[model samples]
Target: MNDADNRPVADHPFPRFSDQELARRRRAVHDLMEEAGVGHLLVYGSDRSGSAVPWLSEWPVTREAALVITPNGDDHLLIQHYNHLPNARRVARGVEVDWAGPSTMSRVAQLLPAAADQGIGVIGPLRARDHQLLSESVGELVYLDAQYTRLRLVKSDEEIERLREAARFSDLSVAAIIDQLEPGMTERELAAIVEGSYLAEGATNHIHYFATTPMASPDTCVPAQFQSTRRIEVGDILFCEISAAYWGYAGQILRTFIIGADPTPLFVELHDVADDAYDAILSVIRPGVHARDLVNASAVIEERGFTTYDDLVHGYGGGYLPPVLGSSSRPNLPVPDLHLEQGMALVVQPNVITPDQRAGVQTGQLVVVTGSGADSLHNIDRGLGRIG
Candidate 1:
């Protein structure tokens, strides 16, 4: 009865969205900003990684780029480079443009006047680059980000439908990886298969990839050994905390699997404890429940024979919208009081460690809040994932 035995079932496929749908998502952003009393929003991107900039503007902001949404409902796409100006303009349909000089943030700062004078409530908080620019230009104009995030949390029916498809694809992708898993296979090799399968199935991103041996610290990223020559071996466990985008919605899926048996007693016991934790958490999820109470309830799993890592649950949405769900952070959870409401999506992952501290195990599921309870979008087998 090792904890590793109860792995979630995986069965889904890749996801895609139509152009009209993309446009609709952007419009929704504007509408939300207006409703929140935001005079203007300055959305910026510093890196090429996951960003809400693309989600809102429909354009990827690689360099110094920002999206300005005014109270009048008008929008603007500002960038430092002239070369990407065309690409930005192409992606921005109705939004105005303000290409600025690369060396200084002054040009972009000039746009903050309306935001400062009337005290524009910012949507997405300005990043380092843009924050510095704003400090110099607008000072502090009652900046805020909660309203914008709340609007995203309660997904529209269309958005829910898209997320459902993405979850389906995530499940299928994991199953495909499981089908490809075998003893002696390197972790890197397995990751490639997992990622490749997602693409072949039509996925554009590898939301995330985490795997490792039962006794090893969780592999949360693609290791470099993948390039050399490493392979999987017996007694190994493959765990994944990944997601994908279908249309404009996001699908988050977590999975765990084991290779050739000879299971450790601790692994078996903790894996089952992890299962109980997963089920317990799932049982209490529903609309009206405060995120903190959910975490408190899940804390009992530790009392029942398991150790916990991170929070028991966290909020999730398209891209990486935050106020991460659940009451698990420094001292206590910091997210403002928000009840689990129908249409809100979440990921409940409960990782367990043995009393001895030698082994750690976990099980997590992605679910959507319903009127009564919660509906799971991800369905991976919760028993020990065994390979022949």
Candidate 2:
């Protein structure tokens, strides 16, 4: 591990983890490539859509990029801008960059094996234009998107520590918001305070879902918008789904807070149900638990006649990675039937909308599926809180 890995703050924008972690990842993927009989492993990425690319390359590209691994375990990092080479070298340790070019795919096509039986495997989506070009002389042309995604589901030893650090930042930022919340503060103002606290607490990135409604809500099924300009009023219920990122790891925290006074009996009851649902999901989650089985655990709330709304659970890294356990409101696309393996990092959020449809409460925290069970990342209360 390097100093960048241990740094609480994102002092260096490049890959903060060590070269060894990068090597380990490459080795794992190389083994997969060999099994698939691929001569090369190509992963596509850009400033916006780069998922596995950033984690693999140790730095996100400002433009188009790709990380290619050869059969001999040699790794190559390609960038669109030649000028990025210097910075890439600074962070993309132990990788060759000279092969990178603004127009890299066509060149990569030149690297394709002439034999029809040999081919390149890709993890991320490749553009149609580039995809067509690369396939011209390729062999098997394996699409290993799911295979690569599953590889990232489990948290490496280094990634788990970073996630814990990120979660702490989110917790501290939320605590600041609650400690200073007062009547007449605009939603935008409160959001700024909360967002700033993220950076103050050493978070590199923050994604928050913010909502405030006066008294109990009329619709409990929907989460609040990301951020808005609306001003808050007295007796409003504030809610947020806070996701904080450090290095490349993320931890999501969901919380609901009532302003000015004590929550009503109905609200408290609803929140308790939501908390129970959260706990219930955590109880049954462990290595080997079916992904869909976790969803069934939400009955603790829905059985009581509360409306379960929004996405209930998902995996987190880089962005909301896969293994999405589906949403309560949307049943058509529940998470797949995959077993939850140990080392996988997931967020379990069970949201309950009061039966009256006037209030909603959501409680969520990050967890890593353990050998015996699951470990909750945050130490905050699991119930609805108050701000006065």
- Pick the lDDT winner: 2
For model 1, residues 333-380, the per-residue Cα lDDT tens digits are 475577778888888876665444445655676788888888888776
Over 1-388, each residue of candidate 2 has an lDDT whose tens digit, in order, gives 1122344334655436765787788788888888888778888887656677777766665677777777565567777777776666666545666546547886666555563466778877688877777777464568898778778888888888888888888887688788877788877788777778778555754577776786644443455665567677767887778877775677788899888877877778878887887888889888888877787888766677777657778887666666676545446464786888888888888767865556777778898889999888887776788888
Give the Å error, residue 381, model 1.
Answer: 2.9
Clashes of each: 34, 1
Tell me how far the alpha carbon of residue 99 in candidate 2 is from the true structure, in angstroms, after superposition: 8.4
Off by over 4 Å in 2: 1-15, 81-83, 98-102, 110-117, 137-140, 200-202, 216-220, 318-322, 327-335, 354-358
Model 2's lDDT to the true fold? 0.73
**What lDDT does model 1 reach?**
0.61
